[model samples]
Target: MIGIDLGTTYSAVGVVESGFPILLANEEGRRVIPSAVWFGDGAVEVGEKALRRRGVSPVVTSVKRLMGRRPGEVDDFPLPLDEGDRVRVLGRTPEEVSAEILKELKRIAEWRLETEVRKAVITVPAYFNDAQRSATKRAGELAGLEVARIVNEPTAAALAYGLDKLGEKARVAVYDLGGGTFDLSVLEMRDGVFQVLATRGDTRLGGDDLDAALAGWCAEKAGAGAVDGRMIKEAERVKRALSADGEAVFRVPFVDGGESIEVAATRRDFEHLAAPFIERTIDCCRRAMHDAELSPADLDAVVLVGGSTRIPAVREAVSAFFDREPDLSQHPDEAIALGAAIQAGVLTGAVRKVVLLDVTPLSLGIETFGGLMNVLIPRNTTIPAKAGEMFTNAVAGQRSMSLRVLQGEREMARDNWRLGEFEVAFEPAEKGRARVGVQFRIDENGILEVLARDTATNRDTVLEIRDAAVDVDDEKVETMVSESVEHAFDDMAERVFTEARLKAEELLPAVEAVLSQGDGIVPEEEVAGIREAEATVREALDSGDANRLKAAVESLDKATEAVAARMVERAMEEALERRMGG
Candidate 1:
């Protein structure tokens, strides 16, 4: 059995031998495989060697970006090259690209183990939405591997660390700060059952952003007017260097025959520059802990995964947040792959008693009148959660009624993204007479499936939401996929803008309420700044610019910390006073 850590920056393949998971090294003796693929001369090449051909070949990284996109949903995906880069986006789905990577892993596993590897377990972000999860499964199918199960990255890390501590129950928080994403999950383990209580993180936030920020800082220090790709790559190198050492000096290579410049960063300075990113993840951890109803002291242990977690600052922040020195014996980069192998054993009945219970990451709701979204399943809700609602015809002799499904926590359906639509036919009857029972079920896999039953006739209809937004045909999918590649960076920027705006809107009213109540000891100038930030956010929203919304909200977030802290304290005090009958 094989386990694969299908990561954003790099991938690792491993197998269980005598109960120990061992990573398989490639011919170059590197255990970590670059998650890069280049198409050249009708051949698909993956990993480090192929990555060298990136500029001329069509290369894709973070294909995971396409995980949950609906059919026909158009967005630029990262091809990481120019349109004339000789790599035409033709007939290859993200699923296929991912499959090629998995296939390479499988081939490596087979070659190393001296046997045909067929079954495997794969790790995914615990917070991966439905589309990404399904795309992973499809990638496995395309690779011709029996995907034993899709295990959460944090869960796998916990298992890799906890297998030695069986029979003892522990509350574990897995802090996974990876190359491209961050996920903090709280789990309870007892009697061979690993139950996830709550999980939170941003799929877009990670080390990449930190590197980009540092790169910009370096560019400014170099007296450059604009930061370019080479500067960004140099900054990333400095970041990686500072991870293990106390200080790192970057000697930037000049691009236009100009003299090279050196930029130095101490670990402390790096942490300061990366403070906002670390703090953002810490906030997410707080939310997850709150959702699980567990405090920092309640966590028996903290486990870290991802290359980013190797940073001393990240470890310190996590330790401070959870109030525990996390177990660092497991290699952050390889832990997930090891845990995946363990899961494979469980699925293959090699380790016959442990079971994992995952949960949905976001709220799934239906669009009501006035575009209000009624949530069916809220975020952090236990997996396999089921809910039912009764529907009836509003007009006389109505034959069909439609159910518009959405996912997100926004109050308005228009604000939330639509997942799909389901329509059920019923026997014609008087207005508001025909009753149809609609059941929305989310499986352990977190995919939504709908079932509608006609109470009048005992007839039933079941529908699985299709990717009507995805171009499935080889040619069309290929063309769109290529187009997306060309526009990938732009698309990501736009998405970030959109998410930021939504977050700002979520915080605005609360900030205003606090100001009205004089809840905190915030200075007048700070309060004014918060208001200013709110206005900027609202303006971005009104303009319908997702990117602007994101930027404005981020600006507001930076300016309103004092206000937020005070508001939270006031809320806590009121709750405490009410609880004590004061």
Candidate 2:
């Protein structure tokens, strides 16, 4: 089995041999493969070939950022597709585009091993939600390889670090800042067991952002219209140069009308521009520590992962934050892939006496009454874990129940990301009579599987939570929170009205559906009262009055109280009958 790090900007493959993980070079003998794909001349190219044609062809880099995110979820990014839609990169989805990179890695592994490579363990960001994890696995399948596991990057790094220190017990923090993502994971390793405590990161913040910032600074100095891929490449080189030297000069020849632009940039200047991005990673680290319920002082050692950690400024900041020198025992680029190889070894029984216990990055739940989120599985819960809730209908003769599965840390269902909605069909029992057990299981790969079992029939139905539209506005959370506080007075009335209108909209359909189900069961006078309340609500909705709509909704609720109770009673009776019959 081969281990692959399907990274955002670059990827690497490795395998275990003789109880040690060994990195495999590509056909060019290069250890790293640029995560780029190019389509031109009726041919597809990956890695360096695709990267070289970036400015000319329709080359797609950082396609990993688009993984698991819907079309409209990403904004301000230069993409070939429109918002809320998918664009075919040579008739391939983003997953398929990623699969091309995986296929390249598979080929490399096969060539080196002199055997077929069919199974592998892949690593993703620790904070990747359910959708991203699923998409990553799908990409592997499309590449004609069975993904044995979806390991977390930082967790994998921890594995690599702790592999030799199996007998030692320690609390370690893994700070991973890669090309297009940043993750901070806190783990406790003891007796060869690596247990992750907490993980947090910004999928959109990474070395790519810093490169863009430096490129923009260089472009402004050069008086160019915009920074192109070539200029950005130069900016990256200058960034690396400044890490060792006090200053570096970035020169672009013939940028405009046979004129060259040169700018001498100092380390201080690069640090100044990179300060905000670096601070963001630090903030994520602090949050992860907080969630893990430990301070920096509590950490035994802080291990740095990702090539971005090579920057001197990043190391200084990390040192300052943790009050100690960051451990650089492992190579930033190869640690994760190496750890993945170790995992593959364990899975194949080639390596012995090691185990990894990962955790879900976000909370999983369903919407309850009043739009509140009822969490079934809290964030950071150990993987290969299961949590279940028993649900029943509110009225008699209800055939099915619909539940919207969500993933996020938000308190409200609407604020969190909707994984998907599923329906559990029952055998036409009274409300509250059918016994349906809904279980959510997160496997070792951090992917979620929901199952609904009918207790009476002893039948189970597996639900496929497909096409999850995750809200991945990584940079907007703080801005939105601050704006909500500062402008709360200004938008209070509009916000109230909007919320009330939404309630009215929700109540209208629910009222109609309940009435349709209990038409003959409900008293005629009570039905008339419910109809009047519904009409009042409609009028209030049209009048654009928040108070009126709220009052109307309350009235409708009061009018249908007896009917709702009777529906529940009928359901309970049906349930009793079914149990007795069985």
Top candidate on lDDT is 2
- Name the weakest run of 10 consecutive residues (lDDT summed) in model 2: 476-485
Model 2 has an lDDT value of: 0.83
Clashes of each: 16, 8
Report lDDT (CA) for all predictions: 0.76, 0.83
For 1-582, candidate 1 gives per-residue lDDT tens digits of 788999877898987777666889888898889887877777888998776875455567666655555433323334432233122234467678788899999999988989998888888887676667777888898999988778788888888887776688999999999877788889998988888998877766677778878877877777865665456557778998998899898777664568786878788888889999898889778878878998889988888889998888999998888777987888988999988888877766666567788887667777653345677788778877899887678668889878787776555566456667777788899967999887779876666787778898888888766543122321232123234346667655555554565466567876677678763467777877888888888898788776678778889888877666776787899899999996
Give stretches of model 2 more than 4 Å off: 76-79, 82-87, 256-258, 427-431, 469-471, 474-582
**lDDT value, candidate 1, whole model:** 0.76
CA shift of 121, model 1, Å: 2.0
Candidate 1 structure, TM-score to reference: 0.74
